[model samples]
Target chain A: MAALLETLTEDQRDALKELMNIAMGQAADRLARLIDTLVILSVPSIRLATECAPDLSDCPIFSAPSAYITRQSFLGALRGEVLVCFEQDGADELASLMGFDENLNTDEHDELMLDVTNILSSACIKGLAEQLELPASFGAPSILATNSTLFDKVGDVINRDQTLILEICFKVESHSFTCDLLVCVARESLPSVIEAINRMLEDL
Target chain B: MAPLSDLLRAVIDELNMGVMIVDPELRLELWNRFMAMHSCRTEEDVQGRVLFDVFPDLPEKWFRQKVRSVLELQTLAFTSWVQRPHVFDFAGSRPITGKQSKMYQDTTFFPILEHGNVTHVGILIADATERAVQHQIMHDLNQRLSQEKVEQQHLIEKLEEAQNQLLQSEKMAAIGQLAAGVAHEINNPIGYVYSNIGSLERSAQDLLDMVRAWREAVEASGAPELVEKLDDLAKKYDFDFIQEDLSDLIAESREGAERVKRIVQDLKDFSHVDKAEWQLADLHKGLDSTLNVVWNEVKYKAEVIKEYGNLPEVECIASQLNQVFMNLIVNAAHAIEERGTITIRTGCKGDEVFVSVSDTGCGIPEQNLTKLFEPFFTTKPVGKGTGLGLSLSYSIVQRHQGRIEVESEVGRGTTFTVWLPIRQPEKQVDE
Candidate 1:
């Protein structure tokens, strides 16, 4: 079967990018307020693929702590994964500054990560939804590990050829952050995306 | 007319809170008037509707989870927070609703049953607002207590850090109290190395001069006088012996260097077991290094006599025990102010290894021996002690599941004996 995307016309792609830019900017602003940090979200690289493993090389999680993050997933018309990852070193450095011990194991490390993630991801996800004119709520968060094989569960449906990955960086204060957003569909959902974004940007 | 159940239900409804009754499948059986007023939904509207369908706007995960557990796991679900709380919509009820001073207490979900199967779940909301506020206050108080404990621990660690610095300076202070002995210890090797270097340099210089002289003699007299002398000189100096001796000297120097390295390393390990915890530590190793730390204190006042026997690696916090050893050794030295011997004997007996440090100094008064292990009850003068040394030792030994025994006679001095179990408690090993 062909990808759900029938080659998007350049104009449609441009429109989607521009709309995403606006949505992400709004999300970044919301995150900045929550984490009390300056946030810079890159215009996410949107690709067309599904159900096959996506190349995770350029993933910022590799350069960051395997812990300390907040992620929210929305599963419906357009199923994808959204993440807010913070560097554990940054966390340790922050803890050091706060005069906390640096010997936190995976559990404490994750707990701190979740506390921040809860605030950051919730704010950003809600802001994006509000812009999209969707009155949806977020799910209770489950802390995740970036350095392990567990991350693949974020998009279990993602595969080599059909799944799409849309990742953005959400910075907190001076610390840089990244969110990996994976969108998967058996066929293209460009029209739904275009429609959703159009409504969101206009409403905002 | 069914006035009885209605009357009883009406009384229950008049009580504070919104209560709802749902069947096994979450079919809304009853929604009170309060729920109707608060939720803006009549009982007839939600009477047969599933909980999730009615509260679709609610957090799906939190709601679906409680619903799933109420059915599958057959357990009630509950949540509470101090501020900015989440409320479950009922016909006319809420959780912890009142003045800020009368915040809601704990809220709970109950699984109601009928006919031995869970047929109904009663979602009851109580105005625990008062209990909630009290609990928050208590929680805040507990946090303050724990924060104080952490502050105390931080101070203790800081004090320990300062103590470690003092001990390091003491080790390096070279107070020259026993400068002669230390000088001898260092000089014995330097002496040989210096002499060997001198002889080697002299021999090499002679050889060079002889070679030059031989070359000049051959050039001047066409004879080999200097050459013969050179050969004769080599034999007299036992060139073969010097050759063999030179190799041995180098080997000896290397060995001495290695010994010095081990001594320095042991000093480090003894001075501060950085982690201050347990490992595959040899009690004998700890004892030896501790002796080095207090060597200066023990050297002149009392001779350290070690009676080492076969001992296994006792699982224990090594640094803590090192502190114990220092305390006992220094005490023993102080006891023998009139110049006596401090004997340290270590051996394994069954599952216990006993280390006894006996001194010929003034022994403890018969009754005072009991107070020796109590923190801050030191026999040493005020400035000389923290009083925590023996208490700390006792606790460290106790943590290792070990015990300390003291034997004393006024004239014969005192012997502090420590018995450590071969297998330490797992929790102790963790520390």
Candidate 2:
């Protein structure tokens, strides 16, 4: 309902935005360390959508001709999902930046992408939960789609209304490589997240 | 009811799944009846002992990380049997029918929180052996189905190719029948034309002789006026040239008619529509007829040479043998690039008659020599060949209890020699 959407006042929204930036910054640091390259992360933009279908269609990841999408689910206080979208050529760019000497076969390529997804999702979700004084447990990451632009693959997971969409872009400096990570908090977990954001706002 | 704690303890012990609790150091704090039954170690036996010390076969590194993740995050962590089966190394639930000796399990770890501090990790192990077995069976069935699908596709392609080849041979047989009918009709007309030309030649010669005799008598009669008049008329009409041209014209006409008769006879012999059964036949006559039958194909590409030796009559199906001969001769003609020689030789050794057709044309490659008789194998482009010529010839030769030998050198030439016995085997003769 619109009541749920307006629950996060301007000050709470600002606090949530600040928390997301700090969490994504930590994820970028971990990735940069792993690949031995400078990784630049954009300030995460947060939005609450009452309609599930329109939000995903408007996402830039689906605007791409094709992309490799990975999904990892987290449980406990921060129960939701994280989606990592690698552009059509993002896999090769990341592989090269990671100093893989030989061309990766299909399985190896999928494994590498999933590993990257795990590293990013675990780091970002854990960091965000810690900031909110909550615990987060991660499931195994899996490839959701390759060479597909259909939003249905991601839409089915975020079926409920009053969903929070957090979008961040990761870029490898000195390379044309870029990827998007979307953190979706399920409707059931929204109130706890909002309460945590309001608590942080009050403490400030 | 007893105290709530005691009631819960009883329920946990009687459950069908394995329940165990380990402290931060992985020291076992509790073990349920399900775990004790499978491991044969009661809670008292495993008390104060590390989980690995009790079960040495456990994957210590991976299990520790899974538990550590749950404890540090203070949340639940899980693993499916598909990801890692046999987490506990317990005996399988199904003793007799289960293929695996160890039970497949799906393990989950829950962090027990006290006052916002993690104290123990509760591990729950569920028996998934039946589901694992069913999944394996489904996987194996899927693999076999896909393999059979590939084999079915190949068989379909082979069947389609065989059908096409049969249709091609059927078309050739129909054409052969039509050619035989046409040859039979032409034979009658050719026969009369040949004989009529011979009779006309003789009649013309007789008339010329009579005129010559009369002229001689008149010249000898001593009538100067009559002789002078005859001489004048003969000179005016150029009678000498006419007499010479008349004999030449008759001879040429007879030769042409005779050639037509030979062509019709060649067509009849090539087809052998009337006498298709086994019989004693001269192979030399068959070879000559086959060569004439394919002469149009050869004339532009090659010259024909014959080296005939004495060949006793061979008992065989003449029509089938003619077909073999036609295939070989035509193949030889096609092998020639621009112009070459097709040498056909026939001879008899002991009771076997061998006929070889050699061509001085582009030779076959060494690799293709063995596959030459296999059906549907052709070097010729599509639509140019049905690839059944040599295969049909091979079968026909096999039916006659004969074999064809080939010798060739690349860029030089090829020779195909067919050897047949003078008589069919006694058993074959009876048939």
Candidate 3:
């Protein structure tokens, strides 16, 4: 697992984390403004995608059995999929904040999930693209599963070897909504991403 | 000569989708022909106006935030038809399905960047009503298919129940035929053996008396030697004890044969082969006969108690009613593990006669109460029950235009009460 992370130089790893921190901050800010609540974001962590497989007991999102997962794909200079996992308890608060009734049917829950995923994924991807000067387009966000195994739902999509994963966590201060965002970049896309980051570094 | 900018404007005007641009202050900078057709306003009227003012129904707060995010992050933003149905209320062009009364739209906001600073936010809207209608149709079809699947499952369950009831009745009919044949075959030999035992006892008494008289005559003829010899022979053969024991042996044998005859008779009565047609009969008599038939099964498990009521002669097929009594009594006996009482009570309620069989044993659970009469539903261990006893009993009562009711409690007891009218209705008989 360490060998996979060793593929990136110390400077590249620090740059990727810094870029993710800025992107996730923008996502948190947008969600806060939309819901009129304060949002807190954690420092993003960069690791090998295979190291994040759910079989690891320490994996945060997978360890929580009751998590709602949403997924979207991005295409541009760097490409892979983005996964947002929301705790089940947090989903209720999020739904209520969106002006939905306390008892949400399946369709209402699905709509709420898609709406949140769209807000966060778009903001995060857009933030990254703007910083890297890379034009990226995001596919429509969709709910993958509710109250199900996160690994089983996303295992096939993220199964490629030597993929890099960036994990970010966020919380709504006044509400109970907390979630984890995982951005997985294809191994082939890493070199292009590194070049873009170095170009921005020289410009800075 | 026309400038290249004028030709670009001409091409934008010919496009099908709506186009608009908003500046940093959220004022509309440009509107295109598609927007003019849908919004009922042209570029001359809406340009330089606030976008919300032009379309009052637009979600002002949400749209402002979207445009702000585009300008602030310099990143593209999107909203699907599902998130918000339409930003502009364009009337429906195809109203056949009436699913969409207004045009469904997918919108995107992109920042127009110049010199690394956002200058304007350009908005594009595409009609999505056709796709929305197709999705609605598919969702409706899926819901209907699931409903049909549920109904089909219920129908299959009902068919299975009917088949089980048919099978149980067929099994009972075959058993009844076999019982009747065996009873008839056993009756003949038992009849003659019972008669011969009675006659043998009387004939033995007469022969013993004749032998004693002849011995007295020989002794009185003064043949002393001959008399002594005869006395020795009688003592050696034990003639006196044989004369005394022979009569008792014949009497006991006669009694045993009588019991065998009675058991065969009870079997015949239970099968009702001799009388199938409906007739007026005493319920108590039928109850006693059923008790005799099932005594061996009940004797060791539980004691039987009878509570008789002044019941009228019910018009029913006696043999079928006997069968019902046998099933209930046997079920009650099976319910009692040991040292419990099976109470068989009968009484009259207006024009109806009721029989109740109750057991002081483990009672049924509340969840299983409703399923008690369903075919193939049993709590007994495998092979201990066929799970068709109660179901068959239920159908038999229904056939006679009667009803059976039960009350039970866990670890306390269970009671099955059957009610039948004294007179069968003519319509019921025809059916």
Candidate 4:
């Protein structure tokens, strides 16, 4: 696992980061359109590993005391899953943003979170797949954990080895709304992604 | 043999689930046998028609969005009966028992790709009525179980309260019986001792008078030798001291006997455990008897003052009222830190009589006043009080259709007043 990152040359890593930034930028735009607010998306970070566990010390979401996490899987030529991490009060923030403060019960809050997860994951995966020129399809997004930042849940959901993790952060301007999106590419499909990255590098 | 295409077509028609294909505009391109059998629309009847047009009950807006997403993302989309009970309102699969009138459906939408571009969407529907019914039954059972759990907890609390009350009352009854028995036994011995003292006092007075008269006669006779001898005997016998102390000794003995008799009478009146029925009784007598019964508890800590007023006979269980009075007096005595005063005041207004016991002891805090009558609520140290004293008193007063009111100021002292009607209502008199 430690040597997994050494396999990617500096050029390949940079190329992957650039692609992720574009993909995450598209996802942030979709969210902005959905909530009718400006969204700030940071530059995406890329990490590759041969096991499910990845060192998450530098990641703000994983290091936080607690978080609300949801997961969505995409299948076909591009296969992996995305984990959308929100702060503890993320439901209130999103509910206020969408003007759903009236009668937003617990079940409704979970539904809203899953809906947002679906939108963000599908949009982000679609963008990434478009750039790589591969077909991707999505499974339904579900709540993996709520008000918790336990890595065990993340590890259980992303059990495949030889994984590539793409990380990005989203912030709503002038609001306390922020979330992190961690996209994990599956083991069997890592070679295709690497091959695509190499092809992009050669073009560059 | 039939061609492979013909055989496949027949196989698709014979499948159990409802299978349909629709174009991008939701125009039905294919409908299977199950769809035709449920909707009562043959393929020829609904061919090339918009799906929503044939089935107006369908959630058109949501279905449209689901199909659009599946087409746009080229991904398989699904819905469970739990989330959406039915995509199409078909009759339930169970016809014999008729437990369900509406079918539950778990539907799925997937894109049909040709040459890598999506052209149509396929829909599959499966009957989920049995699973939905089972889940509903389980949920209802769980709700009832929790409700029973809560009721059981409440019943257990009630049983514990009743048991505690029985224990306290039983212990009190036994003590009352013992005190009455001891008072009865002491009454016999004290009665004889009192009469004997009365007879002795009269006899001694008569003898002394007679002796004095004789001595005067002897002196008049003027016998010098005899006079000298009498004087020597008197001096030797200390006759002056004997004459002075005899009356004093007799008086003290009478007073002691009277006190013992009064105490025995008070004990008999205070218990009345044998006569537990309600009667028209004097509250003053009950109060005095209760005071005497608890005097030992009060002597060291408090000085008691009785401020009595004329009151009508109150209809009540006399023994229970005495118990209440005893509890109040003892509690008043216990409240005093050093030496203080406990005052008993009685009065009448209208048809009600009131007796208030006031103490000059450290008063109860304002916050504790409300919970004073609650069972097991006490400020006294463990074993010093069962905390049932005031609660029992309150209930006894309530049983006579009376109420107890309390007033207190911290460090100033507290007063508890009980008020009862002069006569119980007619219905209670029957009981």
User: What DockQ results do all the predictions give, each relative to the true complex?
Assistant: 0.01, 0.14, 0.24, 0.15
- In the range A92-159, model 4's lDDT, one tens digit per residue, is 66655543444666655665566556656776788789778888887877777876673656644443
* Model 3 lDDT tens row, B147-256: 99999999997788678867865676677778879888989998889888778877887888888988999988999998999889899989988988888898889889
Per-prediction fnat: 0.00, 0.00, 0.09, 0.11
On DockQ, the leading prediction is 3
Q: Which model is ahead, 2 or 3, in terms of TM-score?
A: 3
Q: Please provide, for model 1 over B30-89, each residue's C-alpha lDDT reduced to its tens digit, 9 standing for 90 to 100.
A: 777766766678888998898767777555443443444344323344444332133554
Residue-by-residue lDDT tens digits, candidate 3, A1-204: 444356667777778788877877777676676667788777557887676645543566555664678888888776877888877643567765555567876655665666566666776777677667777877767677777765667655565566777776767768766788777777767777777767756766
TM-score of each: 0.33, 0.65, 0.76, 0.64
Q: What tens digits encode model 2's per-residue C-alpha lDDT throughout B1-431?
A: 11238888899999999999999889998889999999998889998899999989875754675566556545565666765677788988989977788899987788887787888999999999999999999999999999999999989976875666567557656776888899889889888888888888888889889878989999899899998998998899898988899899988988888887788888777776777688999898888888888888999998899999998889998877988999999999889999999999998888888999999989999999999987878998899876888987887788788999999988899999999999999887676
Mind giving the per-residue lDDT tens digits that candidate 2 earns over A1-204? 356567667888888889988877776665665555788877557876544346666765545545688888988988888888887654666655433335776655665566466656776787788888887887867778877763667554454456688877878767777778888887778878888887887788
Off by over 4 Å in 2: A1-17, A25-71, A75-80, A83-123, A126-204, B1-4, B73-78, B205-255, B258-298, B301-431
How far residue A62's Cα lies from its native spot in candidate 1, in Å, is 87
Predicted complex 2: CAPRI docking category? incorrect
Better of 1 and 2 by DockQ: 2
lDDT of each: 0.61, 0.80, 0.78, 0.80
RMSD of each: 22.8, 7.8, 5.9, 7.4
Task: Considering the true interface contacts (CA pairs under 8 Å between chains A and B), give the fraction that model 4 also has.
Answer: 0.11
C-alpha positional error of residue B76 in candidate 3 after TM-score superposition, expressed in Å: 4.2
Ranking by DockQ: 3, 4, 2, 1
Better of 3 and 4 by DockQ: 3
